[model samples]
Target: MLTKQDVHVLRTLLQEYAHAASLPVNQEKQRLWIKLNHLHMERPMVLIDQIPWNEMDVDGSLRCLVADTYWRQVEDNLRCTLYKFRHMPADMVLNPYVCLPRPIHNSGWGIEPVSSRHIELEMGSTAPSREFVNQIQSLDDVERIKIPQLTLDEKREAQIIQEADEIFSGIIDYRLTGLCMHLGIWDSIAMWMGVENCYFALMDEPEMIHALLEKMTEGLIDMIGQMNRQKLFDIHSHVCHCSQTFLEDMPKENDLPLSGNAWAFGLAQLFTSVSPAITDEFEVQYMKRVFPYFGAIYYGCCDRLDDRMHVIEKLPKIRKLSCSPWSEREHFAQVMPRYCVMSNKPNPAFLASGKLDEQLIRDDIRRTIDAAKAHNRNLELILKDISTVNHNPSCLWRWQEIAMEEVQR
Candidate 1:
């Protein structure tokens, strides 16, 4: 089922990544190559000789070009990795497009203008489940989209984030970073109505919550479909991005687990900044309606995950899951076991904490290994954003020890 052109594209991509892996021009590129190599070694069967990878242009001029370039390389390598896992020898990778919240990335949440009346009315709408209906509706009624009125700082804040985001457009995978897009209506609702009000509305006014999710999810699905057609959905490679924990707490009316549509179900669980209670609610109710649209589910993102792990055990279509810094390592090792592959990330504290010694970091990895062993031996270590590491490359070596030690055991 492989074609010469497809295979050639992949080989070129792999070679580029291989080159980038050794040559680190900047911090972002270095991280990208290192991560690619880690994946290649951890899942050699899926990445090394099995799947096809291709290189492409890294868009965005304002951000770190090196990081963007390196990610492009990794994206190509991951294509091959995904192909081997899916048993599709030459198919291009089609992942979901995730728009996450702001808080997950340590970027504080800000208020976006929205209409309570319009949102309330949309909640009771009887429209078909077509995607982007809200956008269409919003466009049709621009007046409804008007903000109640924001303070000067709110406007400036929103603008600042927008400008800064453009700079790091492709560098930070915000979709996976925070779970969902920051500019969407529900996001506005959360910031404007306050999480407490919006949450209570989920139960007190079911129609309102239903309308909000339907509208928001529709926009997301449309975006994903467009990206899929354009072959740009690989940006947010992970399905659940940052929403796995939030899905657990979603109201029974909202929890939507992935349905088995090989193409559509490939990605689910993209909500972010969501709590355990909300994650369950969405998993039990809402996601049920939407899950059939993806091929697989990638769960977990930046979340307060202590309460969410128990719920992950029940998701039926999940093929891969991310292990957040906050999640209990042993819990994942005990729960999903072989059903899912775990991406283990050492907390920022470990790398950012000025106390950078092998013993301290080694203890942390030792604990992680001891915990993951209870489930299965599979694991991948991810050394994410370490501003401090920028000054001290030696700290990275400790990470190598941690990973290698775990493998040796």
Candidate 2:
């Protein structure tokens, strides 16, 4: 239980953050981003790394149901503060709201859950990777996989919103909205069958692989239909993980936002090792089945899409493409400028080196900026997939300093 004093402290901190977010400077910067996203004009924008909360020194004393609510608000405020102080081009908004009917109960593809164990190499690591035991062994197992029916618990959802409102009514606004589904086809299949097994299945059992992909695609389409039927699609106009670009077409107050008004993301990180042809056949073709359901698409993650640019070009709604660290920067500068927003993902490994190198950081940012300028591309730098900062928060602060310096130049 949170003491009255605890609530007072939290409410005070939240109000201060909300006030900062409401400033005109932040609002204009966000509008600039929206314009750049819609291809109305070209400009550079940056989203500082989405740092993991466990990486920071946050107080963990709050407990129970209140603790859950308290921590969520606290973390957002803290990160927003960090971004402002570092001069990173991240947007700040008045309220921190989340959509409901998250669709957690339904595991669309009916595959046996894989067993996994987390192995942490060091203390304060960003997040641990799991060692998985693959559950699907043969083609027959694919038949057993069935798509589960989705059901929304309205009463429980209302109770959650009520409790949150009571706690944060005057401090900050609480909105019950909808969110887009981030459904990855290749990643799910690789999770069921081992990565190696998935590769062999492509050649040894091409027919079987196609059948499994078809089934998974069907399940995802059905899940999307369910979400639409339940009125769970909400407009995400703020800075979100769904896309690096901002939404140009947001629904009006009286209108219900559909998936077409929001950004949808699709990735095939596991398909990195596969040939472009195989990736196009197995991943891109299946993804196309679901991509049209959204207003716009954000494609790629950690994977390099250099060879498969042609395949990606086929997606009519793709508005942003991830230019990962592994991608050829020069090549992408030439290809991506004419197409979509170049969502450049800088390598986060520098943070784990235990020492901050200002020169190295500057040079890295300079190279990316130079390449983007030469091609006239709309760029957004996103620093993600960080595992550690070696307990030095200053490294991220320095990185933002260097990145903004380069952007201004």
Candidate 3:
């Protein structure tokens, strides 16, 4: 039950969101994103995500006024949306209607790792120097990672809509949509045991690695199949890993599950040192089982995949290829097919410094823009994995401005 204050807070934000959505710039961004996604690009696009919202403390932007924990989250979201629009809205679409996540509970894959040491940083965010606890040592131990089952609570889901409607009866409407499904098998393996152990096992116990991967692969496929069978693949994903995803290809009006309508994000970020053939054998082969089921796939993350394109390209339905800061941008721009959207993930480390280097950030964006321009590739700049902005919110605002200037140039 939302109090009058909660309803007032929500309705106020709803009016602002509705007004922002009515703007022509958002529609133009939608056009640019659709063109880039379809590989019919006139110019480059920019998107910033994985932002450090904790640090964006300007005039109570992040401070929630609501009382209830759940409603406070709703208030926080509305506040953040309006804040981003005012601050550094890159190429993201400000959708008019409100969206509520369906109450879907997942009986997760049962494996937990331990975090022992914490490192407080002077510049970056505090992180855990996790105790690389090995949960999988034997072949039978892999059986512990179960196939995740999802249960959608319809009553709760309806209650949320009813509550939202009673609050925003004439303002903005709401929809129950799911989020993007990212399938990273090796990432899961790294989480369960340890990233270092994952590499060591590949060399020392290759058979064990294969067995573990095989089970995990089967488990993920089972999860996807269950979602499809349950009609739970309906996602209204605006972006997948900071890359714009709204496109004509991913039909909005579809009958079959969104497995064949939306995108599936995949990556093996720690596969940086592994050879193409080895990655192909261990990672790609297994992940491809989960890939073919999706309408489209956006592959790679912070990994330098320029050299590994031979193996990387083997995965079917790959529309977006991540060209991270480590990736040889020129090589990827020249090598990747013109049809594939080159999602150039710019490094956010510059902002983590004591002071922002405008020229350095400018040069980075310039280099990527040049690479894409030279090869005539479909390009989109994505700044992600930002842990901290050195307590300065202007770091990101300036970054988006520079990125937008570069792309629009």
- Best of the candidates, TM-score: 3
- Model 3 is weakest, by summed lDDT over 10 consecutive residues, at 122-131
Runs with alpha carbons beyond 4 Å of true place in candidate 1: 1-207, 224-232, 235-277, 304-306, 313-316, 385-393
Model 2 misplaced regions, further than 4 Å: 1-10, 40-42, 58-65, 68-104, 112-117, 240-244
lDDT of 1 by residue, 255-374 (tens): 222222222222122334456566666543454444444455554544434356665556555544566676677765666536555666667566544347678777777787667655
Q: What is the lDDT ranking, best to worst?
A: 3, 2, 1
**TM-score head-to-head 1 vs 2, winner:** 2
Q: Per-candidate TM vs. native?
A: 0.47, 0.87, 0.95
List the pairs of residues colliding in candidate 3.
none
Worst 10 residues of 1 by lDDT: 44-53
* C-alpha lDDT score of every prediction, in listed order: 0.40, 0.68, 0.81
Superposed Cα deviation of residue 89, candidate 1 (Å): 26
Candidate achieving the largest lDDT: 3
Residue 197 deviation, candidate 1, in Å? 5.8
What is the Å distance of residue 298 in model 1 from its true position? 1.3
